[model samples]
Target: MRRLLLASCIALASLSGCASMGGASSSDIAAVLASPSRSADDRQRDARDKPAEVLALAKFKRGDTVADILAGGGYYSEILSGIVGPDGKVLLVNNPGYDAFGKKGYTERLANNRLPNVTHVVGPSDALGIGEGVLDGAVIVMSYHDLYWVDDKMGWPKVDAGRFLDQVVRALKPGGVLLVVDHSAKQGTGSAAAQDLHRIDEQFAIADFRRHGLQWEAAIPVLRNADDDRSKNVFDPAIRGKTDRFVHLYRKP
Candidate 1:
């Protein structure tokens, strides 16, 4: 009995290790991160950046529809529009807080590029109005932290993770993808730094979505730095713009 228990524990440990370390080759990841248009610092920070592969894994077709939650600067949105081709659509969803950076200038920049497939939608942090059961995928890149912040003084209400997931689930077609990438908070911390430093606990994110009927398809620690202590805010001078992050891909049931 003792031997059987020991062997089972060993197997479980090995499986856990495999789960965290799996997915995409280092070379494939390197190519995306090394694109010339991206800054050297950004490239270096995300050594295993593979946004294209993430889209592909979601089965995004040439003409499929996509929603970019928190499409700040339209970086990924632009790339997605090009990939989806002229026939597809890319909704650039931005929260009210993001408008502090100026919408006119942002629109002008994207207009110069003449990306016909992309459209901008502005609204509250928690809700995005696209459509029901039509999107191929919705990618939230480093922006879900805002959901934790609404105007309490104005009775704006707190972020209910359950309601938020239901909204995304309703927006996506059956088996559609929900890809999330954000700065990784420390394990067991349970979203403590999300409000303070704009980072989130990846474990909490996975569990929260799962509770809302989303299945955890896979997780890739493409840009993890196990050394980060999470003691300092993500924007602290020491870790600002270079915090370790986790990239997770989940699917609606």
Candidate 2:
């Protein structure tokens, strides 16, 4: 309970910082929501995938180079490409396991679309293939916890989350923002349970990032809910696809 209050205070401070920056206009929101490269189904998927209101609140700017870490299926990759425009680049971080999961069909789709600004990377589990101090910002959406799944079968030679985060920190420019969103789990819940439940305890995540020199930025209830019991698996029919989630943003200090 004490920890929860502390987190609440930290979130309020971050919200104040965000409020100091000007918010996006409705027209800008429409432009992102209506991007032609995104299919109708893709746009609909964005609602649950990226969530426009949340992205807008993130204040991602045009001409800002960005990285979409763990870019599964390239859903957020497409939206980010549109947001960054032609001058800015978007690197899609694709691990070998992800490539195997998506197969050659994923490669063909990108080739057919011809997104010149988008680049696909296949690199070590610890490091993204981007140069240092080049990125403006990076986002890991519902995929950060997968770092825990790195094993021989996953083609990840190592399973060290610390090493993985070190690589992420190295890839970013000084003061670069790293926004993470994942399913919220209960307190004291460890990684083993997180894997079974497909959710992570928010406090554990914050502490892990802090250990890596990341400053707590914001915690938004934009997708939060108190109803989830965290007892069921994420794929369970009841709360599988519709679990209450949290969006936490962090920045390199």
Candidate 3:
């Protein structure tokens, strides 16, 4: 199955010149959604993730240079690769703090460097070092709140949120998009929930994004779970994957 995906990608590369013309098409989403090469594990998660819809909401397109911030184990990286086709590229980035958990699996996914157009970028949270105006879009999947996460024992750095936002802004080209999805924290709660509950207030997130000059484009409520109490830690077994989440899209001017 892996070979089939690889071969398909290789074949696509040969026809890539014409693939970028229309940006991402509905067919692109359909192909990725139906690909036989996708693993059962990924397929199982699909019911909960609704990736194709998420990608579509972000208006992700062919030939885009997109980044998956704190891309843990390349789940979205792999899907974006298939969606963007051979003409596009996906940059999977991990900061030092998050790398401990993600590095090994990410390396394994890229073993033999099979996904040619996908590149792994590692750096500190404060300084991403992405080339200015190089990226067309970026996504933070349930990870935007990590800007406030700190774990000394595990070597997680105390992230400076403002500096991190500055770096993200610098990485994007004008009109580039930024998509953020995260677990919802209680209303009126600030960064406290981010550290304790592994979540954030959606409004707080929007304020931060606006502060960094990203205009809020839209919000998707597909993942909302009204029953979620939003008080417990997100890792609690019962609400782990079912935690109500917010999907927000922003754009650079």
Candidate 4:
């Protein structure tokens, strides 16, 4: 039944001439952000995250089945729920490590089935349990660096980056969009800074996705902070919410 509904939605999106590059409108983003159900904390973060611009770059549309990968605390998951609407579905995926770190936030966010269209899925990093060719889009916000991060004490295992990306790529239908947003490391640093500064080189991330067969689409610059030198840990108080970030959009072709 769910698959049937999703198929219908996909068909409708096709018939409507949905563009592979951009579809979200300013009003569409405004309506989602204006929702009263959003928590105050998320609203506060908006000033720094500039979610409106980020969502505009994603171009997610009504009835799109999207996934919020490594959805810590369901922040993006909740907002995605509003964008996708009741006809659409949002997969809030998290591995045990992320779940353990964000239990309280996601717990309260999901309590009483607040987000009816969002399905919280807890699974291993290598296999996120999403069916192949099932998603219209997927977003990895501030968590892609975790693929290269390893801390046994923190319960975050060394993720097989290639295998992990393969799962996300396989889940998207041809022409599906993948949006990645993460803190930027110094040029050429690659994934070396992922564990230490919780950052990844923007070029490395683009190349990583391209290697997995995803076409690099756009690099939105709304979140870039010129002041960040990319030297401090992302959690450092001086740059916690003000890090220089990179937003890249890709397509499965």
> lDDT: which candidate is best?
4
State the lDDT of candidate 3 residue by residue for 130-189, as single tens digits: 778888899999888888888787687688899988899889999999989999999899
What lDDT does each candidate get?
0.65, 0.68, 0.81, 0.85
Give the 10-residue window scoring lowest on summed lDDT in candidate 2.
11-20
- Candidate 2 lDDT over 125-222, as tens digits, reads 66657777777778888777776653565565545789878778777788788878887777788555555676777888899999998898887777
Extract clashing residue pairs from model 4: none
Worst 10 residues of 4 by lDDT: 12-21
lDDT computed for candidate 4 = 0.85
Candidates sorted by TM-score, descending order? 3, 4, 2, 1
Look at candidate 1 and tell me the lDDT of residue 119. 85
TM-scores of all models?
0.74, 0.82, 0.91, 0.90
Better of 3 and 4 by TM-score: 3
The whole-model C-alpha lDDT of candidate 3 against the native structure comes to 0.81
Q: Put down candidate 1 lDDT per residue, 1-253, tens digits, no spaces.
A: 4564355334333332322343223333333334334444444434345564554445454566888876766666755654455566888877665644436545753664455678887766557577689887888888766566555564445777566668777888887888888888777777767766677888888987788778989876656776777677877888776678777788887
Return whichever of 1 and 3 wins on TM-score.
3
lDDT of 2: 0.68
In model 4, the runs with Cα more than 4 Å from the true position are: 1-22
Cα lDDT for residue 64, candidate 3:
83
